[model samples]
Target: MSETVREKANQSLAMVEEVTAVVLPEPAAANAVVPLEKANKTQSAEIKRRMAEIDMEDTQSIVSFGSAAQAELQEISQAMLADVRNKDVGPAGDSLRSIVSTIRGFSVSELDVRRKRSWWEKLLGKAAPFAKFTAQFEKVQGQIDRITDNLLSHEHTLLKDIKSLDMLYEKTLQFYDELALYIAAGEAKLADLDATVIPAKEAEVSKAAEADQVMVAQELRDMRAARDDLERRVHDLKLTRQVTMQSLPSIRLVQENDKSLVTKINSTLVNTVPLWETQLAQAVTIQRSAEAANAVREANDLTNELLTSNAKNLRESNKMIRQEMERGVFDIEAVKQANADLIGTIEESLQIADEGKAKRAAAEKELQEMEANLRDTLAAAKAKKTGLGDTAGGAVPG
Candidate 1:
């Protein structure tokens, strides 16, 4: 194959390798396989081995999914589940649900899991123990996101640098080509100076007499100056080639750096990012699953509390109803008799008030008639006195 095609093929192979074999830095906390603080020496060593397995990027690690590590993780998770089940407090149901959900979610069918999986993918599938601590998984999720963001940013910077390197590489090649052309032209000029200009000037000096020697010497001096100028130009071009060769090292370094960055970016894009997305989905599912379990548990507790309170209330109400049913607190006969007596008293009081009102009306009529009779009698007496006074005045005038 041609050199360009061969280079392209190598790049493709490198990309594939980078994608499948991304080796990320291990998180400090996640590397601890178990949460046991006071484990024995043997257990601690075993835990360390498991943690190392988790960090391993090779398929040969025994702790990879479907391997012995899976079984060990399952056993540890089950033990933790049993401990939780035996406990009377804490979000036991929620914790159990989360663990079960994670385990089931991680276990992939043939259709879901591709035949060719990286060691990290296997490790992720085998990490059933992480399900037990949903909170810790969530915390780890944040860290993973931050790391992924940084890797993406790094990839961006690398791409920019690689672009710059490519531009520089092209410019350098162009410079070398132009310098080569300049050097070729300078060499040709040097040949011409030696073959023609120097020989002609020497022949002219030799043929001249002693009287013409001074003029020939001046002409020789000018020819020598021209030859020196040509030689200097050739030397300058050679030096430029040397300087260009010196710059090759730095260019190659940049090219190497560009290749390394490309490999890293490919790794992140294919492996690290995918792993993160899968784990994050698992984490979120576990969180929501735990929350749902806790919600159900809380609802059950509330229902029980309400039921108990209602039962107490019903009991108190039943007691009152039972008392009323068994024996009466007030006399029904007495209440009826009192109500009848009150109606009779009210009726009697109404009758007496009507009679008094009638009497008052008759008395007021009689008093008004008596006052009218007295006014009429006084008016008749005044008229008689006036007539008597009038008769007495007329008799006196006669």
Candidate 2:
């Protein structure tokens, strides 16, 4: 060929290369030539040889070859992928198989030599890595399942313990309420007895003297009995405390040695129980003592009234003198009898008041002790519960 003709040919080829960005081997694969999504051995070797000839020094040509191969690989991948997708669209079993087949087809497509991976490289080519992923995934999933089991079991246990505590709170409240009512009733009864039984025969010295001594002895007996019963209830409350302490470890939060955890539990306990316990106790004490004291004061006022009335009657009777007695003047005997009856009623009332006082004092002491014990046990339970929560939530600390 002439130099000018050859020069023109070369320039034309370069222009075509720039425009198409592909420098194919002369007389390249034709439209009539079949394409394989999977490369045959000979075809793969030719692609490799052709790519090795192209160098970065000839950047234009290499990029052109890479582009053309990529386009060819893309078309092949699409056709094969569609064929595989049609064959399998079920669950995990078919999904895994489809992925494997897709990866094999991709490996065969790499015969184009310049083909690069797509975004689904990990997903489509999962044969080697998927096995390992599946193993670890199952293990992590198993861990989640175990954590779920712990959650359910812990929930049930926590609920049961909370229910027990609720019942204990109610029982404690009942004790508080009963103590209050008992003290009130006892005081009222004593007040009535005091007003009714103080000594109708104080004017009859011998009868009044005998009644006073007997009444003092009976008052002592009643007080002692009430004190004994109160002590017994206090003892039983102590027993309840002991039992609760034994169960404390199961829910104790303190031993975890986490200050935030311990503080949180303390806050919760103080918020939920101790504050209420104190409020209730204070209210009960105020109500019971106020009612009892008022009754006692009222009875004493009645006693003072009776005394004043008797003094008036005695003075009036004295004026009647022996003539009144002979003529039944002023009925001084009726006044004397009334004074004796009032004295007897007052004595009885005083005895009952003393008994009620003794019982209430015992109850207050017991409840205070119970409240302390409750606080301690609740703290323990909270510690345990916190420990359980941490264990359930995270990996063990190194």
TM per model? 0.37, 0.21
RMSD in Å for model 1: 29.9
Residue by residue across 128-231, what tens digits does model 2's lDDT show? 33233334334433443333333223323333333333333344333333323222232332333345433322223344466585765555455444434433
Clash count per candidate:
0, 34
Candidate 2 differs from the real structure by a C-alpha RMSD in angstroms, to one decimal, of 72.1
Compare the candidates by lDDT and give the number of the best one.
1
For residues 157-219, could you state the per-residue lDDT of candidate 1 as single tens digits? 445444554555455544444444444444444565588867887898899999998999887
Off by over 4 Å in 1: 1-136, 209-212, 246-252, 280-398
After TM-score superposition, the amount by which residue 29's alpha carbon in candidate 2 deviates from its true location, in angstroms, is 99
Clashing pairs in 1: none
Top TM-score hit? 1
Candidate 1 lDDT at 315 equals 100
